[model samples]
Target: MTTIAVTAPHAPSYYAASGLPQPARPALAGAVQADVCIVGGGYTGLSSALHLAEAGFKVVLLEASQVGWGASGRNGGQLVHSYSRDLDVIEARHGAAVARSLGSMAFEGAAIIRERIERYGIDCHFRPGSMFAALNERQVRQLEHHQALWQRHGHRELELLDAAQTARHIGSGRYKASLLDRSAGHVHPLRLAQGEAMAFESLGGVIHEASPVVRIERGDPAVVHTAAGQVRARFVIVAGNAYLGGLEPQLSGRSMPCGTQVIATEPLGERFPELMPTGHCVEDSNFLLDYFRLSADRRLLYGGGVIYGARDPAHIESIIRPKLERTFPQLRGVRIDYAWTGNFLLTLSRLPQVGRLAPNVYYSQGCSGHGVTFTHLIGRVLSEVIRGQAGRFDAFAGLPHLPFPGGRLLRVPFTALGAVYYDLRDRLGL
Candidate 1:
């Protein structure tokens, strides 16, 4: 119901600075008809457009900015499997049937990413492993349980490492142990996003950058309107996620946008191996966690902390530098070349919200912080649902989404209070 202007340029992050060169796409200027019209240009929209186009559908994708301009281009780039909340939590909250259904698709996202990189020859600096670093025994136990839970869900590529083993992989002494996922990895997120956009266009999908949808008129064929033009399509896919703004009231209440920040150090050159010998991306096992990896040029790309209301912190480096130093004290005075923030949609359930606004209007959002891989999977699922295969899509859509306890005005403070409590618990090793 509320229309927000989409005027911001891409964040000046490392990804944006070094991303693949892409041509500027013109904004939608005239009426267009298509089999499907997709909102947003991030991973979800790009993936849906690519998949649907491949399926022989005439697809037109509308971007508020350039492709990968949102979180899709700005994420940590770690290929973390599963959703924000793990399958164990899903099984406990919902039933095993729901968990099983969701679990079957858990690792599929990462697989889809790898397949795309290979099939499209996307040079996104694809690496092949991720580590879950454990700072205390409690976290180590959690990682152990995490490994077991993933194994139960048919993910057998995990290996638990003792402190000594972990030391070999990560030069830091901060972690007590770690769990390595061979199948999980990292990539140049922005490059990957640009590549996906290219792939989508290559399949005859139309893309309009700087075209933000102002409203949707539901009918036999949905009408999506922007400032310059409108799209009439049989089906409309809303993949905007955190940047979706106030376009749909149905989705606005159930989720909140939260910002996360990252900083990239000047390329580590010869010292890279001393920090990450195996080139594995790592995320610690704390509720509010730190994830870092070696970038293609060997710079340490470290990210952590969350801003509940998606507000950019004044000094991103001030917030993250301490954590980075704590992990590797040797890099205490390392010069940071870039620092930036991006927002991700957070649902109360910590699972994605997927369903229909109307019979012909479908949406998928709220990946919380674990969207890099899941968004791609959801895109494919959205295409599947459009193409008459709704089983997998139904499984995700069936999950219940509860609104935040506090109303819009109070949600941010309330969530921040809760995060502080959990952070303290994490410090106390409870």
Candidate 2:
């Protein structure tokens, strides 16, 4: 068991380079008391803290690093609906009742983000429209089914585009079809996180940075011990996703920390529009996928290449640049300005793992790399469960979260081998 820490500046991603300035938050000092003590400072934790504080609860949030320090601030920034696995898969593995319940709230997370930006006046470059592109006939058929499946769940805002239409919007010939969701959007993630932290503070919530919880003395009033301080609270929420290593044995086993790297090019200026004609964030339909979008300043932000364990590529660009060039050959020599990597929790079920770790201790993790939007929704659900509205929370809890077959020790190798099969299928257009 190891602990993750980041007593440093945010990664040099383009989002961090251009996002709004943030106030330096203080670390936990002495002993503090609150109705709730939330661990982690990423999307889920911040969202949970903000909503909980707004609900009139005294909240204290502890982050090992600054806000948006993990994947929350370092994702591809393409916000869309649905879980990591599609709704049909959820239905097949679970059941209609469970799938329907999860599907109904699929779009709510994106709505929550938009509402936050509008309500808190957060300037995270909230841009609407997300496209799921199909690269082969099999993928096209899958998308066709995806559209119908979403429609059955009361989602009718999807716009299907033929190859020509897809080309028009995508400015690339690699895709055969597209499913566009007008309500889904992209944002400046780091800024959104920072803005959210500010809003939480404004709502009388307290945030302690660099105060990694070293131990949790669980009880009626759980005590969360940090390196230099402790939080005694009525309830505790563990919102740390992938960056949370070894904090709890149960959590580390049921979830695997998967690493993904992304790169941002030097301001593309006029060339940006040629690449993303409509400026809609796009992700291709594949088991392991590629997602890209234009930054507010017009730099092309491309992300791909997933690693099952914690080792990041020696140089992220060395792995991602080829994908970027392959996707847009015209930008063969494009100057890469920023490259970095972050980890997201992946569950064996490919669904989010959310429920109580103890009677008074709750947790939410493993968004399966599709967490940017879902985290916000889970945040609300967590707050609701903490306050006695367990109906919605129970829906997620009812879903099974199996531990990796080989546990943490061999889960990485086993999962990586399984992924190679799907990667071949994707390559063969199966």
TM-score of every model?
0.98, 0.97
RMSD in Å for model 1: 2.2
- What is candidate 1's lDDT per residue for 1-430, written digit by digit as tens? 5333454578999999999988768888879999999999999998899899888999999998889999999999999999889999999999999999999999999999999999999989999999999989999989989999999988999999999999889898888999999999999999999999999888898899888899999998999999878999999999889988989977988899999999999988887467898999999988999999999889999999999989989999999999999999999999999999999999988999999999999999999988988998999999999999999999999999898987798899999999999999999999
State the C-alpha lDDT per candidate: 0.92, 0.89
Candidate 2 per-residue lDDT, tens place, 1-430, comes to 4334446678878877887887777778788899999999999999999899999999999998889999999999888898988889988998889888999898799999999999999999988999999989999998889899989988898999999998888788888999999989899899999999999999999888888888989898999998777899999999888988888888887888889999999987775466777879999988889999988888889998789986788799989899888878888999999999888888999999888888999999999978989999999999999899998999998988898888778999999999999999999998
Worst 10 residues of 1 by lDDT: 1-10
* 319: Cα error in model 2, Å: 1.1
Clashes of each: 0, 0
List the pairs of residues colliding in candidate 1: none
Instruction: List ranges where model 2 is wrong by over 4 Å.
Output: 1-6
TM-score computed on alpha carbons, candidate 2 = 0.97
